[model samples]
Target: MHPRSSLTVLAAAAALLTTATTATAATEPVSRAQVAAHFDLDAEQQPENITVDRDGSAYLTFSFARQIARVSPSGRTHVLATLPAPEKANTPNLGKAFVGGIARADDGTLYVTYATGTAELTGVWAVRPGGRPRRIAALPADGLPNGLALDRRTGRIYVTDSVHGVVYRVDARGGRATVWAEGEALRPSTFAGANGLKLHDGAVWVTNLDKGTILRIPVPARGTAKRIQVHATGMPSIDDFAFTGRGDTLLAARDDNEVDLVRPDGTHTAVLTAADGLQTPTSVAVHGHTVYVPSAAYLTNKDPNLLVAHLDR
Candidate 1:
């Protein structure tokens, strides 16, 4: 990760996100989403990502606060772990240590990404039940690791570097990270790229923030990436997305206060808007038929909260 630049980058990204949402305003809403829990905006409780467990509890990464927290099914919230801050915390684009995208393994181990612009602390962290959090793999000090996905079958973790425009793979047990994929399609045009990642159907799915596109890369048994294919386009400022478990249909969270249902045919419909208590949503998580969205209020700077909705099966 590089040092924080001027506000021009933020302004440009905000404009792109807002424009993309406005273009889809004509689409009819599919779900009436509601805020399940409101965070303390003054205390930097801006949630950057989320993962829901089988027992109905939700784990979240508070980006600006550099903390990981858990919210119970009944709405009780508590801090689970806090990442250490660098002595000179100046992360690329964000200007501070950021804790983003989280994935929960079947064994209840939580893997979260932390970017601090320093090799000493920037990497993937593993948080086990009743245990201290520890770094599993150290990433490049200049790379901004934004999204993470865990392959439980192979016991591996895949990370997306937004600043460096590449994907890194490392063992879940903790070791060095190696470059998994890097191509022109993952490169950023202006602000950030390769922001979200997922493992599905023998392939790796990712989203490019600056390019506003979703990509699918075939993963063979050799752990190498095949040709990258563009799955969908016209999604600007997209942060993270979750599949709805119906074919390839998915819910994509836009940082500009919108959520869209994207079909396998590349068609999309705006299902949720700002009226649904979305204050700059950062990521989406689908557990069964329930949809969870964490709004960080990164740009709007309004109510940061967790929004919930049920999908029609």
Candidate 2:
């Protein structure tokens, strides 16, 4: 979650785009209000991706401590399960056993992406409420799974690989995984890292961490595919995004201490900024009118727990 020096050029380009886009609409910035509840975790819990259930409960992934946390609407927090630890002497990044991408199916089964320090040990897992987690399937060496999205219509699970810059599709029952879409420009200079992903309106939307852009690839009925840049500018280290229930607004988490609301008409306004005390805002999800943001710093300091902002729809 540290500031990436390599993203300087991308940040500069996004800033220019933001300035140009903001000039046209020029809507008054909406004031953000802290909600009624917040979950402050212990020093060991570093929450990442979050998903809300139909019952108003939230499930989030803990990266550093390797666990899934279940949070109640009242701000109660409980550790669901700790991921299996990797073997000794594994690669540094591959050795840390943790879950990144988490999504809940309609049946209440939680599908989480488990990653060992090494690429070979990375895979997906399914965990039911109050039960032990079971491995779904192992990912390929190039499949660096980071984000998870479930397509309820076809029962397909979309997983994004940040390292290899590809998205893999697996059946709900954990069948053989195949490449759903890979960026056409594989070179580092062209497309850097593909981190978070969301499936909406027959298209897959992905956030490029290193490139600071959001890509949209249409879900074709068959054959090879290509992705187009739907919103490439106006994002600073865009990590994860969620569509507001209203369908016209998008909440995006900027790696910097801020979150923005992007309208469907291609205009955006800053909703939560550094002034609100957001530290490395990594992931965001909306339920009802309340938007929940998981701050990486909350793993250490219990002060800001989960930042809740009430949206004026």
Candidate 3:
């Protein structure tokens, strides 16, 4: 836990539990709006990734909590499913289950990645809205799948292995997996940790949290793919992104303690700053014009909760 984060959490807890007073706004200039609501989670809810559906529902992975949670536009939250722990401990300090990438298919089926400290337990999973989950394919031992994206037109799923710094493609039906792209640009030598991914305009957009860059890769059957830098001007902790309704704009949760709204042209504005009690803003999802940001303020004394920001634009 960082020292500043601890202080911020203590202050937030004092404000939330004891008083209704608002915290000081962030120093960075930002469009102002009241927090619509706060979705409270358990102590271990460490939300890592988020994806929004057409119906204004958000699917989020609680990596530390080992469960997938669904948040509706109405601010209602429910645990979708919890990953089962392994029958026997495999590795030292390795928990029973770990979850990373997540995506939803057109037919409303949700797919997520699960891994254990041991190589054999790492695989992709498919789960229906209210149905059972089944393993799809086992990833290589060195592959630490982190981000997920589904191509609706091609019915293909793309997975990013942060550990190996490579992207792999899996069939929608889940059989064989193949490497799609891997290189210095796609997987740079320095800070190549990939976290979030999306398919837009026939190109794959991925966020390298460590490098603080959103990379664009042209899809297959389209000749050679090149990595294009999208947004890297902001702070170095940009985590995940949620495309606005217009699709031309996106809101990136900086996890370094702020949130940024970035345009396709590279222009960005700080929509939420730390002053508003944002501690480690992690995952972001937008529905309609409203944006949802979930924070894991474990380092801070403040209680962990989801922050809602309504875009007046």
Candidate 4:
């Protein structure tokens, strides 16, 4: 990737210095944890992505658990839906289902991704409150669908296929899937590529887990890259992210047990960590200055927990 312009670099440094001063003056980068109540999941549930409804209820996907759960703002949780098991049953050693991403439509519908390429387990699933799981779009068995983003205004859903290093577009209402974008930047050097996703600043933003970078492709993109800009580099293997409703972003670095704060210029600052009691904090959701994280714990000492951290108001 090319280096960002010197002008952009300067702006990021200025932002970084200012943030450092503010964080120092504030004592804590993020406030003490606040737990919510809408959880139907137990310590064993391996929650991957979190997408919140308009009413603030969050729908989280359990990656290897074959289930999706809705946790209300009050932290109450219930089984929202489940993905199907692979036809041959557990492939190799992993679970039959590997649900990856979750996104909520403006109308309360939730879209999720199942990456396990088995049984009929590779596709995008849509569900509403009290509704049955519906396969909205069947992806490729050769690809592992890992990230999801919705352009609700246009009724288009963007999905990332980790294994194939490509992005797919499907009708939010249900229909055929098409290759939306693909480039060398998305190809994984090791295990994962094109992992986390979100629509921001009129572009589709994605994270490469193996590459530890975030790339943004302009909206209405087609073919290959007209341009793919590196939004942030040296990310801590970020899983999924939530835009702060402002220009900043909160990135969940699952393996690092930390949430990284990214500024407008794309320089990430360290914010929350294990000292904050984080345990495999896989995804983050934001409402104003408050950030919500699901700590899957993934066999850690603590049972799976929901962690809340408040940034500057």
Best by lDDT: 1
Superior by TM-score: candidate 2 or candidate 3:
2
lDDT, candidate 3, residue 40? 48
Higher-ranked by lDDT: 1 or 3: 1
Over 4 Å off, model 2 = 1-32, 35-43, 89-95, 184-192, 298-304
* Highest-scoring model, TM-score: 1
Higher-lDDT candidate of 2 and 3: 2
Error of 4 at 3 (Å): 44
Query: Each model's C-alpha lDDT?
Result: 0.82, 0.68, 0.66, 0.70
Model 3 misplaced stretches (Cα beyond 4 Å): 1-43, 87-96, 188-192, 222-234, 298-302
lDDT (C-alpha) at residue 4 in model 3: 71
TM-score of each: 0.90, 0.81, 0.79, 0.83
Query: Candidate 2's residue-wise lDDT over 119-191, tens digit each?
Result: 5557888888778888777786444578889898888888887767788888878767787787643212343
Residue 127 error for model 2, in Å?
Answer: 0.4
Compared with the true structure, what per-residue lDDT tens digits does model 1 show for residues 159-263?
Answer: 999999998899999999998988999888898999989888888899999998889988878956758899999988988998888878888999877788889
Query: How do the residues 1-313 of candidate 3 rate in per-residue lDDT, one tens digit apiece?
Result: 4677556534433332232224555323233333423444554666667776665556777766767888655556788988776565242223445677788887778888776655666777788868877778777754567788888778888887765667778887888777776765455345446667777777777777667777777785853345555555544777777777665577787876778878777777786877776767777766544466666663463555566544555
Question: What clash count goes with each model?
Answer: 2, 5, 1, 12
Q: Indicate the residue-level lDDT of 84 in model 2.
A: 72
**Candidate 4 residue-wise lDDT, 112-229, digit = tens:** 9876656365788988867888888888876778899889788989999877888888889888899888898887878778888888878888888888888898865445336678
